[model samples]
Target: MDYKLIDNTEGKQYEYHIDGVIAKIEYIRAKDKIYLTHTEVPKELEGQGVASALVKDVLNDIEKKELTLIPMCPFVASYIKRHPDWKKLVLKGINIA
Candidate 1:
């Protein structure tokens, strides 16, 4: 499946629209860092890799924008653990478990 990810800055989230439903990652931005605090995929859309794709794009955007990541969301943290290369974008003093 082709997933399209967009940063909805006004909403403080990154959203993915699929089948008219939205899967989003909520965040709080401070200076050059962004704290990813929550991730939600509609129950009907769960287990379809939507969350993983959203995180991948979000991490890539963080990298491209040269922003530090503080993954406070368990889902995002778990994604980072599986994709070690994204660890470099994490904020200093923060650990993903």
Candidate 2:
């Protein structure tokens, strides 16, 4: 499966396309911190690890830019909770509540 991540500025989100279909969507912003919100992967794309790949790519971009992350998206928040290794990238004092 050929998947690619593209930022749709007009939509204020990053789209993950698998082949030609939008397999997943993630809202993002870069400022004092990188905030990720409302991530969703199509039902067909679920359990295929596409979401994980998308999140990793976004986090990699954040790391490359030396930006902290605010994972407002539940999926991202949960991902961070499960992956202690990624905690270092999170924005300090940002409540995940």
Candidate 3:
């Protein structure tokens, strides 16, 4: 399940286009952390791991950039819950919702 993830900086989001639909995770950076504001996967891309791939790629890039994550999106939060290893990327003392 390899995807060509694109960092559309001009759009301020990470995008992965599949099946003619775009899956994206929108974020806002504040200081050393990125607040994951939303994740959207087209209905056509559902159940194919597109959203999962998008989030994973974005999180990996954030880690590489030495920034932490503040996941406000439920999808990202649930992803972190299922993958506890990524919990390390979450900023401490911050309430994630």
Candidate 4:
């Protein structure tokens, strides 16, 4: 399933608009790294892989922009734990676990 990921810079979040609801990952960027603070998926969209897809796309976007990630959100950390390949995007000194 392909979803368009929106980088709402003014809102400081990456969003996915689907079925009239938005699933988002709030972030804070400082210098070369981004702190993924929280993830939210509407109740209507839960258990539908919306959160996983959103996090995957957000990580991809971060990689493309050559920014390191710090998975401050538990959901994002767990996602990285499941997908070890994405761990490369995480900042060197940070541990997602």
Best by TM-score: 4
Alpha carbon lDDT of each predicted model? 0.93, 0.76, 0.87, 0.95
lDDT of 2 by residue, 1-97 (tens): 4356677778877778775567444556667577787788778777988888888777776788787888888888888787767888998887554
Q: In model 3, which runs have C-alpha deviations exceeding 4 angstroms?
A: 95-97
lDDT of 4 by residue, 26-91 (tens): 999999989999999999999999999999999999999999898999999999999999999998
Summing lDDT over every window of 10 consecutive residues in candidate 2, give the lowest-scoring window: 19-28
Model 1, span 5-45: residue lDDT tens: 88999999999988889999999999999999999999999
Task: Give candidate 2's TM-score.
Answer: 0.80
Query: Which structure is stronger by lDDT: 2 or 3?
Result: 3
How many clashes in each structure? 0, 0, 0, 0
Cα lDDT of candidate 4 equals: 0.95
The number of residue pairs in model 1 that clash at the backbone is 0
How many Å off is the CA of 71 in candidate 1? 0.3
Q: Can you rank all candidates by lDDT, best first?
A: 4, 1, 3, 2
What TM-score do all the candidates reach, one by one?
0.96, 0.80, 0.90, 0.96
> Which stretch of 10 consecutive residues in model 4 shows the poorest summed lDDT?
88-97
Q: In model 4, which regions exceed 4 Å deviation?
A: none
Residue range 42-89, candidate 3, lDDT tens digits = 887789888888888988988899998999899999998888888889
